[model samples]
Target: MRSDLCSLLGIEKPIFSAPMGGAAGPDLVASVCNAGAYGVIPLWGKPVDQVAAGIDQIRALTDRRFAVNLNLSFAYEDALEACIQAGVHGVSLFWGMEPSAIARAKAGGLVVMSSVGSVAEGQAAEAAGADIIIAQGWEAGGHVWGQVSTMALVPAMVDAVGVPVVAAGGIADGRGMAAAFMLGASGVWIGTRFLASREATIHPDYLTHVLGASEAQTEWYHDLYDVAWPNAPHRALSNSTARAWRDAGAAPPGQRPNEHEIIGTRPGGDPVVRYQSYTPLPGTTGDVEAMSLWAGQGVALVREVQGAAEIVDEIFDEAMTCLAGGPGKPGPN
Candidate 1:
């Protein structure tokens, strides 16, 4: 059954994949959308032409609806303009709230989805004209924005905002989606689970680690991987770099262990140093283990890699079953 959020965003399922940087490429995004769920592509901080091309690529892949996310933490005017010009169905603004940016996207006839970490931020985004609010909790993978857990934040955000609330962070399976619905969320915003999708551009080693990790394997950091995106809190799986930092008593940035060591190189020959906030995509070479391996607490639920469409279908079907029976009730055996 289509939720109000599904209708609002012109999709059949109230499931929106998190725009996990390079991993949320056109193929995966298209696959998710084609499965009747919404997908999001990350074009944050990308050049205007590249942003336009990404949207075009998605258009070529599927006629289904999707959104392009822009990190408000960086300079995004040009990229936002490209999204508006491309006539994309929606735009996700994260990291911080920008009313003018939201206004511009709305003015361009684009539905605006903004991610927030707190009740105050949710209210602010709504007041700024955000069409939907993605309440990102602390357990989310990648660059996280808030300190509250999903259980605590979703209901509060729902209570605080008039717009539809999408509960993000630590939600990977149908149970979490059902829980979100019980908490008054219009939908669920999932990221870490998608990392195991066959279409994700993740390194083999990174995928392996994610598959083997448990709910307790993830660690929340206050800017540990801060080479590029400093001062942002994030969640990542434990690795040698993390062990070193813990061994060193969680030293500060400038004094952290392996402060400036080159650990890997991007596909384009850009150097990736230790403690850098970079996901290990395919073609990246060097000490991949030392690079940032982002994963949410929900990684435990993601046992194997599947096609993006399969994942969308599985979660959506399971969620419909669980939601039908009510929370804590098992679906038909």
Candidate 2:
């Protein structure tokens, strides 16, 4: 049974991949779209030209529709305009809400999806003309917005908004998707599970950590990785940097242990310091483990890496089985 939200987004499956920065590259996004599930490409903080190029890259890979996600915490007016000009299917906004931005996107004929942490935020986004509301819980990877859990936020958002609600954070397998649907989510927004997709561009070490982590291994932080991005609350695997900070009294930014130490370098020769909001990609060199390794509590269920299309099919099948009164496995096949 295809959800109305799926039809609205022009996809067959009601699964929307999270717009994970760096990891959600064109290949992964295209793979998900080709699988009839929605894909979201993270384009926040990039220049207008790069944004256009990124869209073009995805277009070259798949003819199916997908969205470009923008972090409102950063300047995104130009990038949003670029997506509008490129005739993309939709735009997902997160981190903050701006009615003007939503109005402008809607005016440009884009389906606007906004991520919120609470019922009040969902109502505000619906009022601001958001066609879809993504209720992100504290267990979500990367930058988390709200303090509530998915179990508590999904139904509240559905009841609070007139638009469709997409449940995010801590969802991994078919059991999780079925649970989200039971909680009144029209669709599920997944991030950590997709990190294990073969098409994802994350570093091998990062993938290793995701495949091995448990539900209790991830910890929520308030600006722990705040070199380029600050004042953002996020969830990532508890690693050396996190342990060091906690061991040293969980000091605030600038005073944290080894605050100025360079942990690695990006493919483009940019230095990556400890506690910086940087995902380790293939070309990254130097202490990769010490860098920020983002993952949700769903990491416990992501036990192996599989092709994006295969991953989508497995989850969809299992979710359908679960919805049809069968016992769906809690972890990946």
Q: List the residue pairs that clash in candidate 1.
A: none
Q: What is the TM-score (0 to 1) of candidate 2?
A: 0.98
Model 1 C-alpha lDDT versus the unseen true structure: 0.91
Which residue runs of candidate 1 sit more than 4 Å off their true CA positions? 326-333
lDDT string for model 1 (1-333, tens) is 778898898888889889999788999999999988999999987889899999999999999989999999899999988888888999999988789999999998999999999999889888989999999999999989989999999999998889999999999988889889989999999999999999899999999999999999999999899999999989999999999899999988899987889988999999999999898999999999888999999999999999988988888777888878854335475
- Model 2 C-alpha RMSD to native: 1.8
State the displacement of the C-alpha of residue 293, model 1, in Å, after optimal TM-score superposition. 0.5
Quantify all predictions' global Cα lDDT against the true fold. 0.91, 0.92
lDDT of model 2 at residue 203? 91
At residue 6, candidate 1 shows an lDDT of 82
TM-score of each: 0.97, 0.98
Candidate 2's C-alpha runs over 4 A off are 330-333
Q: For residues 80-122, write the lDDT of model 2, one tens digit per residue.
A: 9999999999999998989888999999999999999999888
